[model samples]
Target: MASIHILLLFLSCTSFVYRCDGACAEPESDTQAVVGRGFKLGCLSCKRRSEVKATATVEWYFKAKGEVDFVQIYTYTEMGPTIENEHFLDRLDWNGSKRSNDIQDASIYILNVTLNDTGTYRCFFNRILNYDNYEYTTVVSKVVYLTVVEKATRGTASIVSEVMMYVTIIGLQVWLLIEMIYCYRKISAAGEEALREAANAEYLAIASESKDNCAGAQVGE
Candidate 1:
């Protein structure tokens, strides 16, 4: 009876240890969003086993049209350039610089976002190494989508005022584009004119010297 009890106690302790080794599994965040007019994308969560003494690498993936093969939007490792997708080359940035094994709450900032920024994003945490040659674990958060809408100002107004505001904003944008093109053309034209004037001056000097030489030859003859 004493031997049987000892064996049971050993089994119980082994099970407890196995459970506590990786008991704090990372939790995923729900779908979050921000106002389309504001300069914000959303916050994401990433975490790993608390007891594991390993660095975590975070990566963000994005997909349009709900496709399975998502493209990599951003990647953060130990040391290197933060890899970004071609589409978001200049718009996306890490919101903060906080890192840990249990949980990482990182936000992303997007500037001057348009309708094309709307899509599904997934945050991932990959363990850097495994204990005693154990396989590394990867945890993924739920997909989040961004919805952008036109901003409404001055309370709820009549349809005419709303339409006028949109039209005015679009018109201003078009005018600015036209002005830029005009300025570029003017600068190019001035540069060409300067080159033409310099060439004409060189030719005039050569012609004047040739005329003086011809007059001198006639006098000698």
Candidate 2:
């Protein structure tokens, strides 16, 4: 049992590490941003095979609300991040992969967003996969259409989800409380029965001993 517990702990730790390294899940970016707040443009391009080593560079482009062409806004490579557009200078920051060059998450963040910032943004990834004898290259792109508003509004779906989550939590707590009460009552009843049986056995033993003493006295007489 001890060895089994140790093995289970090791497996859990391994799974946690694997997920932390990269879960490789792609979630859509939130397209609504309130003015004067920060917003993150999410983009993830995961490698199909993790065993193969790879290096990647990311480039971000933006088109203003009524722009005819998309302009390069930012780029992140091994050399580091560079802001290419004057409009987003010092406002755009890299919010994605770090420590290694195998860029999977290429998201970016914008500080103090404005109505002028509302438009379509594009994230492009150039990845080079390294094999034993050869190297392969691939390109991946994702786009997000953003709208800036003065005040944030919660969607009906979001409200419903929150209500459901609270309901589920309350239900689980009630169920757990009922189970604990049931177990306590069962154990208490069993303890009471055991004590009663012990008391009866003691009484019977004392009576028998007294009767034997009386018989011995009568014999002496």
Candidate 3:
């Protein structure tokens, strides 16, 4: 819950930062789960950005693979979350902020997840604010790409394959860190060389001027 609030603070700043880097501000995350198990879909809204605030609402929708339209499954607002979808029935759990009315974490844990759940889930956070008689809205949304599988094989071969994949990922991360350090050092060295060259050129120009003045004075004398 503490982490959720921290994340909200970070995301709220991006809302007003302009659209140039909006893509990075809100990145779609993916989650994998096995069938007949429970999975949580994470979502958070302004819930309330400022103390002098307005109303906040959250909605979750689902779109199966190859589908164009999304269906609403859950919603939360001042009235609290109401599982509106008949399909989810009694399997939906509000495992989010304790305050149901104004929820910070709209994350929902779905019980007995099935293969049909494989697809994209969208979480919408709508905030209506009225400051100084001017009403405005700040909306924050997130996409969760859920991949549900019947079963994940855990045989000897599978174990080896998983281990190798993990190793590859770790190796790539290490390589990237090393590359960043090398690049930083190289750039610093180049900057130092440029400064040295500029200083040496300035000194030479001053020396030339001094010699020319002395020669002229001697001639005059």
Candidate 4:
């Protein structure tokens, strides 16, 4: 019975760890956006193997800087490629004609682009998997930075934006370092307190036995 209980506990802990590590989660792809007026932004796979199942829906969205509106340019569903935004209707084309749910070789072409297109773009997938008697849905999102510029002059906005972003990242790193140092100190203090308590308990036990021995000796005399 004890062995069975130990095995059950081990399996429970393993399951919890697996779930915390994002089991059945859709993996994200790396995105790169270039500043050339007319260039293609490519999405590369971090890993070689294609683990995503077939019949997943992939969608692309473009959001201009300082704009709340999200323009849906391309969407691949079971029906076919549906293009909603007229501005990108002619300019945007898939690099590859072939589309597979498992393989993500999606690329977008922007021709005769202007500076207004500079913003963050994202690619995501809504995955549905049928298991046993039910279906489950999971969403995965990845972002890319796109900066459009003139043919002759470089845009200062992109550069300034990048610098500010780096500064914010550095600030986060500093905060994390401070938090780690604080936690280390707190843990060390707690460990010392535990050791002190154990030592005090040992001394008290020895003192109690010594008092009892003295009383016994007096009684014998």
- On lDDT, the leading prediction is 2
Residue-level lDDT of model 1, residues 46-154, one tens digit each, is 3444455566566788776456678888876656227578777877776634554433544567666666666777767555545776756666464667554455334
**Model 2 weakest lDDT span, ten residues long:** 1-10
**After aligning candidate 1 to the native by TM-score, how far in Å is the CA of 151 from where it should be?**
1.8
Overall lDDT per candidate, in order of appearance: 0.65, 0.94, 0.78, 0.67
Please report how far candidate 3 places residue 172 from its true position, in Å: 20
- Please report how far candidate 4 places residue 148 from its true position, in Å: 0.9
User: Regarding TM-score, does 1 or 4 come out ahead?
Assistant: 4
- How many angstroms is residue 75 displaced in model 4 relative to the true structure, after the best TM-score fit? 1.1
Model 4 lDDT-worst window of ten: 23-32
Q: How do the predictions measure up, each by TM-score? A: 0.44, 0.77, 0.52, 0.45
lDDT for each residue of candidate 4 in 156-215, tens digit (9 for 90 to 100): 876899999999999989987987788788889999999999999999999999999999
For candidate 2, give the lDDT of residue 110.
99
1-221: candidate 2 lDDT, tens digit per residue: 44477689999999999888845778999999999999999999889999999999999999999889999999999999999999999999999999999999999999999899999999999999999999999999999999999999997889999999999999989987987788788889999999999999999999999999999999999
lDDT of 2 at 163: 100
Q: Between candidates 1 and 2, name the one with more favorable TM-score.
A: 2
Instruction: Enumerate residue pairs that collide in model 2.
Output: none
Off by over 4 Å in 4: 1-37, 44-52, 96-99, 130-134, 152-221
